[model samples]
Target: MEQHSPSIRAQAVALMRQGVPNRVVAERLNIPRGTIGWWRSEDRKACGETYEQPTDCPRCTTRDFDESAYAYLLGLYLGDGHIISKRKQHHLSISCNAPQIGLVAAAEDAMRKVMPLPSVSQRHRSGCTEVKSYTRHWTCLFPQHAPGKKHERRIALEPWQQEIVDTHPWEFIRGLIHSDGCRITNWTTRMVAGERKRYEYPRYFFTNKSDDIRKLFTDTLDKVGVGWTTLARGSDPFNISVARKASVALMDTHVGPKH
Candidate 1:
């Protein structure tokens, strides 16, 4: 038995391109046929980046953005990386803090303009709405994200159940404020991971807002009945502080304006 040093998949792929049969590929390598096929797929992925990579990066070519591909990406972005049993056939269900229908609409519109043959929804079977659902994947053509380019990911944050965030300027800003509390994207600023998980602050992201703008941001928080705090706890358990103590109190007491 002549042993090979590299991965069996690489060896198998080399053999496959050489016109080897599954049985021969299996027996010659002493590996399973199914494993050979799986390796072939893995090899294909190595050639292309994941769906989350910057779209049209040339190097990161994705499968055509059809219904099936959209379903997988939707699961990656809006769902829990798993498709619901109920919607395996027709529609893909997604959840996120809905952004502006206008923004989403604009994206949809842009996608349509680019591919005029099929409407995005008709061709891709994707529909956007207002609803907030929790998931690990962020929905944007550029999911992993690039700085100054982070806005690319905002479309994924659009929620359907509640009013879409796209229409409200303050809501959008609030989201920016909320997201800013997290870690700095290494693309734009020097990022320092916290000593522990969740010990890291939720970076407070902003798009070049000045001091007066920040004050207006706090004012918006007050007006919207949303409380926020962005202080560091020198030695606190959570290791961070919240500034909008009063708004949180109002929210807790259920004592403010309603949408």
Candidate 2:
């Protein structure tokens, strides 16, 4: 650490206390930014001040943000995202298939668009990628995050979140499909006029164990004029199927396939 005169150190601290940025103070005083930062830290400690990382969270700051990206992110969070709001570990994590690089990028972009201040990173494990944004304010954005599995608890959106989803229903649906839904093609062979013919059926499927989540998805589909039905796997009905030709076409136009 480079030593500086007491008068210079005092001047730097005064400038910092007046809300001047560290870099600005460093430039004005011809001091290293690191030294400026160290002085500021020491001053705060001497004053018994607890430092909190500044955040630009829309909810906390009451500022306008990218609601379209937020709507999409909300769908993804409900589908396959989780938040850890522990005392020391605070972050939001969205799991995506490793093969779907596009989805991974989309998830990261959405996080950054919603809250650009917090850092975002990706972790690869097994066959999936976990996209994480480090911030405790995620709970403010997604109040639905709870201690238990989503399926074991009641999941409902806040009024503000509902408004965003209603405004950008297509984006929300796209996010859901990207996270926990898929489009598949089923084909069959038939005899037509003594000739063999093949036909294919394309549909969308969204599978979630939570009844509330499934209802939310179906309700949104209804609002968008897309038809859907519930499919029962043996006894548990966890899948929402969009098989009608018109509905399939609508989904294809908006949600399409993952990646």
Candidate 3:
């Protein structure tokens, strides 16, 4: 019989630590299934933590979670993030356009703050960077997740979730606006005293197809004492405009453009 190398055994241990089952690790690494279990037991004895499927919810087990980070992540998920559930596994995927690298980095940072254990990975696709994590408690944290497009469904936050958002409204709005909104300078020319003068002003715009989600965004802004206007009635894609100097300044203070 042939023996496996130390590196192969170490790889097997690493995979098991990432929540991969013993049978799957054995098959992937071509190690004996019996030895995989023995190795896990030995590793647990040495480390005091087992590589086993969590019996309780990760959110419940986490005692030192940052509520502000979680709220911001919730806003991001409501704006541009999505969850895919397959069998017993769930994946959270958030994509930022190529130009918004800072927002992408911020999303990854928030994910690390919320769930530090699971590995987060990034991939590039069609001029966008997608950050994803494999975790079971994604739905638990964002109960607004459901099948079908977000606009077609009624989206509401729970009381506890709302409390978190209330405490950190700026961060929540930052995540939401960074994901689906934009800040730009609007310019116009006016003829005054026989001379044409050009003036430029800053404005913020948030567009989404879902009325429920749009309402949620506007409601949050309202709670934060920021006023906004609608483009028109029956707009194909609903638009919320924040053009007042005061409101723009307030948003600029809290949620500036993504770098």
Candidate 4:
């Protein structure tokens, strides 16, 4: 048979039928890639038959799929630079969490021996593309948090981390605040000057998923690099009130520019 792309195309299609990429077939057939893509289109034109799948992907339209292409795609999605295009695969899927994506991008980057934090581009998926991302649970960088033990592991979120979280609220995103010199249990529970008791604690409130109220916590502790620790039991109410009052006072003062 002629070794033109048409012939190569037939062989390539046969190989692809068993599932193989163009680059691999190109390597196997010892054919220049121009021929790989060229003859197929030509043959399809002549025969009035086309195997090309119409992808709705607007951003990725110019590119076809294969090993190198898939690698480029995965790299692109994971934020690789060799391909000068949109690096973020920021799929609307809630599957992959922030940490997992970061870790995977980091690892794949290392394996490919490419630079970390690749450059991206302006293209977008104009049509619907159905790619799935792996989901991950939120990982506390503090790594000390066990189930229901968030209080014991108070890892101060750095300003950069807070900023990243702010940019991508899709992360295990939250705003954080810290308290200092707190006696969670021992506090004066006296309204007058006589009978009083200091006791256990109630609850610990950390920032979760609120944006407007986010800065209310993060900004309050921006420059304050210090930390505090106190153990509070469930029996303490008044002390908790005092603590909250302290927090409120500080927040009102710091949160002010209007007040």
- Estimate every model's Cα lDDT from 0 to 1: 0.37, 0.93, 0.85, 0.33
Q: What is the lDDT of residue 47 in candidate 2?
A: 98
- Estimate the Cα RMSD of every predicted model relative to the unseen true structure: 18.7, 3.1, 5.7, 17.4
* Residue-level lDDT for 33 in candidate 1: 73
- lDDT tens digits, residue span 1-259, model 3: 5688889889988998898989899899877899999888988999987455652344577466788988788878888899999887788999889777888898999988888866788989998999898877778887877889898888888998888888999988888888888899999999999999999999998888878888888988999889899896564658889999999999999999878
**Model 4: per-residue Cα lDDT over 83-183, one tens digit each:** 11123322211111233334334323322332212222122243312222211111211222233322333435446344444443311211122211122
Q: Per-residue lDDT for 77 in model 2? A: 95
Badly placed stretches (over 4 Å) of model 2 are: 1-39
Select the stronger candidate by TM-score from 1 and 4: 4
Q: What global local distance difference test value does model 3 have?
A: 0.85
TM-score pick, better of 1 and 3: 3
Number of the candidate with higher lDDT, 1 or 2: 2
lDDT leader? 2
Off by over 4 Å in 4: 1-10, 13-19, 47-171, 174-259
- Candidate 3 Cα outliers beyond 4 Å, as residue runs: 5-51, 54-58
Q: Residue by residue across 132-243, what tens digits does model 1's lDDT show?
A: 2222222233232323332223322224212232234343333333222222312233435743332322223232122333443444455566555544345322222232
Q: Which candidate do you rate higher for TM-score, 2 or 3?
A: 2
